[model samples]
Target: MQAGCTGCRSKADTFDIAMAFQPIVDAETGRPFAYEALVRGSNGEGAYDVLSQVTPENRYAFDQQCRVTAIELAVAAGIIDTGARLSINFLPNAVYSPVACIQLTLKTARATGFPPDRLIFEFTENEEMADTSHVKTIVETYRKMGFATAIDDFGAGHAGLGLLAKFQTDLIKLDMDLIRGVDTSLPRRMIIESVVRLCENLGITVIAEGIETVAEYEALRAIGVRYIQGYLLARPGFRTLPEITLPGGSIAAAA
Candidate 1:
């Protein structure tokens, strides 16, 4: 095993980190559907500041720490009281074994009083996977454990459709590149509309990420985008859950 994998399994920490939460809003009700826990420096620095320190020997430990710390902080932030899911990013490559690696996460969740079913483990599609079969195993295992699974930055990665074909995740996050200026780009609208339709058919929820303006929000809402996460709704609140500011007159979708 690599040195990092060994430390990852041990989950011994040599770094100090913190979390920032960004809410993913329900387009219909304008309520927070979930809060994604983004990593940051303990002093509230940007993600890059903390991520830049990660090395091969600490990749596993970093990944494990992220899960425990996010859950612990979210509980302190009262996320469970809001009835929103806690969405956490996980590294597939760092996982030595799904069942073995998840013990710490399970313990943290229990200790923090966060329900296991309300957790969402998200994996970025952009990260190259040396073993896709292992990725599938992680996703499936998480699903069976009552936690939701999501693919982040869906269309930006090479694995796009191929990953979807291999694993049936609960959610797919549309890359910011696809959402940027989507209100003005006919090609973008058409492509997004098609993707929405496909995901709807697949029983997978789609979340439009990186929304920053009313025009973009309105455009996505008009096209039946059900969930959204971005600055237009709220920015990541470092070590806190920032108040969500939804666009005015945002109506709930019909039941």
Candidate 2:
């Protein structure tokens, strides 16, 4: 850990936490493209149990710890050798300084021998950004450091196209509300198609999240979406990395 990380380390005494992982598979190859690290209680409780304890004072610590723990556990689970990316949800508001806050993460990744290029820092829409400039700095800095950045829950939050226009992100996760029943709804399909097109134009990869059925999955695949994540593939494995099961397609085996 860096010298600047002392504040967060001191604040880390507030809570105990763990992680769960769900694979985000490639639509064409059915291979694990990434594993999103979801927070959980150390005793196997829900995310709420862990997140409810996060306050402004400890937010920085919590965010830092989450990144370190996720990478540590993923390394222990051999995810570093799987050639799959690790998607870690980060609290942009908690990040006081992008360069300073990232030192611990850099140290942890290096210690574990995980590839920095394969790390994806996902910013959630639920966390209202008080300063867009700070958020932009975080994204830009992370990208320059050889890590990918993404906007999570796109349609469900205030930071939609407007925010995307202000900063560059490598990917955006389509919210479940926009994807639910999209297979049967023309309007939903049209909306998703338009979003996909817009993202494609901006050179941002689109990931359809929260898919629950074969119909939804097929619909997304047909829409030319190459990346996907949801219970239809695998649920978050509490303190573990869940196995991925790909739907039958032209590709016979897991890539």
Candidate 3:
């Protein structure tokens, strides 16, 4: 097994799972800034694949382990500072086992001296939320414990908008699909503009993903979307972090 495979063999049988951080930048700035940790799996071919093929019952377990490993790697690599934040995505169902995951995360953070306040949990809105009340309770518990919460893929999920209204999210990642051609598509542009406005009104920060063109970047910036993550700026990979340069060419290190 590779160095990062902690729970791959014990719980979900054999699989090669790894975690990599994708830098999220301030749209105005071109610098590589905040890192969004992503999980990938390999089937002995030495190539990483999406974890979606795992059985639903075991996927959460694998994901939680990936979160732990990702944080560990970041700390070891010195990519994350005591005050700098790291974002990790989770499925809605993972909240059902919030306590266990929380305990593990806290343990790993303590071991690496990574501050709990610098950790953000991003819940993907793609899956059907099994129980909203339970999820709300779980999110509230984590919030009180000093972890930031975010809703991922906001514009393409079943409960995307509804979840945003119900939960107090520190961040909302705009679905890439919704943003792909937003620069030229009037209808899509309008939808994104409205969502951006709504998020601003709610005092929530918005992050536009899958940005691959200068036009898309400019359009998103014009509409007041602040943070962005996509191939246009930087592909997700392991390397020395890059300085983020704003649209106007002002560069700054990650805070």
lDDT of 2 by residue, 76-170 (tens): 87787678999999998878778888888999999999988999999988678999998999999988899999999998887787898899799
lDDT of 2 at 143: 86
Q: By descending TM-score, how would the candidates be arranged?
A: 1, 2, 3
Q: How many residue pairs clash in each candidate?
A: 0, 0, 10
Model 3 CA deviation exceeding 4 Å by range: 1-15, 28-33, 42-53, 239-255
Which is better, 2 or 3, measured by lDDT?
Answer: 2
Candidates 1 and 2, the one with greater lDDT:
1
Mind giving the per-residue lDDT tens digits that candidate 3 earns over 1-255?
231233322464434666566778865545544677776543222223566456665665666676777788777656655244788877656544556557778888899888888888888778688888777877888888998888888888788777777776878889999999888999988998999888888888888988888889889988888888887666666523444544444555644
For residue 5, what is the lDDT in candidate 3?
Answer: 32
Q: Whose TM-score is higher: candidate 2's or candidate 3's?
A: 2
Single out the weakest 10-residue window by summed lDDT for candidate 3.
Answer: 1-10
lDDT of model 1, residue 120:
96
Clashing pairs in 2: none
- Please provide TM-scores, in order, for all candidate models, with all chains considered together: 0.94, 0.94, 0.83
